[model samples]
Target: MTTLQILWFILIAVLWTAYLALEGFGLGAGMLMPFLTKSDRERGAVVKAIGPHWDGNEVWLLTAGGATFAAFPEWYATMFSGMYLALFLLLVALIVRICAIEWRKKINSDQWRARWDWAQSISAWVVPILLGVAFANLVQGMQIAVVKPSDPMTAVPVDQIDLAHDVHNLVGGFWSLITPFTLLGGIVVAALFLSHGALFLNLKLAGDLGDRAAKLAAPLSLASTGLTAVWALWAQFAYGSGQPLAWVPLAIAAVLLIVSTAATVTGKIRPAFWASFAGIAGAVAFIFTNMAPDVMRSAIDPAYSLTLWDASSSYGTLKLMTIVAVILVPIVLAYTVWSYYVFRAKISVDDVHPAGLLKDKIRLGENFLATN
Candidate 1:
């Protein structure tokens, strides 16, 4: 692979890490609805805690996709076409979450808000699980075969695959996506998100709600750390290309989780929140680290694995993308940091219009906006 291809590959990994780190807690907030809050007002508090940044966090996902399409068209096409159902579900979950967040307040009825709240929670949970499965599939490799467009049925042996004409296709159906390892990954990811969300609540909530999330923070972080440790160790030995370098990020992620758990136990809310963020990013680091040299490994045959060289777009394309990304990415980062700084304050049940604030409720509907 050219230097540009390798650089773009690493850049894409960073984008994915940023998305998971930023969006994880928002998704976790949804997962915490049933456990952290008993009433709609409390639920509203949890939602509002993440309200300003959730949509912006989604931009990383789009940026990642665009980068892939531009820098590695073959990888993008193979992945999207192969994992259509799962990727479709990811989009559906995001859409449902957006709808639930925006429409929940329109009608101002208890039932309307309750239904949307449930939708948000369910979608939130599904998103992490699906993300886990997809990433795990990449780590473990899929049943992909290289074939010519004309003879899609017959497989081109990996040795004979013509990078110019033959295409890599995932022949296995949706059921093939499920396996013990992938299932473990799904649950572990959900656990991490739940823990991360609880940390966010601990950091951004006040009053009894904060206390409730605070109590959940330690146990959830501990449990998630344990689960991830198990999964990472297993993957390190089995699918990690037997490389010692993979262990570095896995260890860092595990240690961060431990630190997060301890920090939360000691009531260090901000540290715990940031620790959770970095921990998730570290875990993502391991996924890409272990899966490198081969972007998508072929379980059917080692030779069929798609490497950076095989999957990348032309050198010119990658160079152009790198230049554009260098220019635009910093702007996105600056905006994200600025928005977070502006919204960096705790939210409480009182900040929500109190539902009983009927005077303003009648005009604005029961929405997340505080009257100030």
Candidate 2:
């Protein structure tokens, strides 16, 4: 309702968009590990391509979640508590993903690396699918109800209660979340990330490996475009807010994805990668835009929905957070940009040794430090 509340909601959406755009390809590379790489050296090239950027990419997720907790405590509490199982699985998968990536090359054993490769591949799919499902649920509306602090299921703390005092609670548990539309959403994002990752591999690897990645990217991007088209239409017609504006971002997403697929087929890998990134970003924007005044919609009853005004923290808190964000966000952006620029060289299979480190450490070129 208030300008600051709306601004924070938009900021949170932007953070989530950044997370998917940056992390999607990294995880997608992991998803491709088992299928794309015939040899450990090739897999090592894949790993090196994503290694310097993955951890930094994850920071966006952390920031998004933290912002939600701080700026929209009620929304955060209800969503996290209601969707605990799915998020728990997501967390487990993330932990497994990190371990798989960090430890896979440490032992320098083929058997060891293979096991980790499968784990990473599985985790990679789970993360994006669950995330997509969760975000889709947000847009499609959940079984939410309004409850007072006396209610056991409601997650609001008494101390945080204020102007909008009613606590919003999710009615059903995990089973309620599984739906045909939501499943399609899961598939859509998984395909999107896979396409994004393949394009990334096309950019990052050299020789036959890069060409193979490019070859795979075309089909994956094509599939992503088709899947996204189906899912976007389904969402817009069924669960969308029915506003004319909602269709704009969805339309942009579809067009960008088509451009991405075309670029891949035409051998324009850089444009293909960027178009895929922009397409995903546009899709996320549509999701947020569709929500409008409500942060969490109620399928049980319209009156029970949680709006941005109902969920937002105090004005003073928002003011302070805005100040902090202004000071820190640019620093983070600068570091991310600088890091990527410094490590911007393509990694060849020859660069990776049996241990997955650089085959030769004596190189002092700017790209040489990417191994670090």
**How far off is model 1, as Cα RMSD?**
4.4
Candidate lDDT scores, in order, read 0.88, 0.88
Which stretches in model 1 have alpha-carbon errors above 4 Å?
Answer: 354-372
lDDT per residue, candidate 2, 94-120, as tens digits? 999999889898665788887888898
RMSD for each model, in Å, please? 4.4, 6.5
lDDT of 1 by residue, 1-372 (tens): 678877888899999999999999899999989888989899888888888999999999999999888888888888998899999999999999999888777766777788999999999999999999999999999988888898765779766878788888887777889999999999999999998998888779989998899899888988999999888888888888877888899889888989988898898978988988999999999999899888888888878788888888887777778888889999999999999999998897999863322333465555667765
The local lDDT score (0 to 100) that residue 220 gets in candidate 1 is 90
For model 2 the local lDDT of residue 99 reads: 95
Clashing pairs in 2: none
Clash counts per candidate, in order, are 0, 0
Worst lDDT 10-window in candidate 2: 155-164
lDDT of 2 at 144: 81
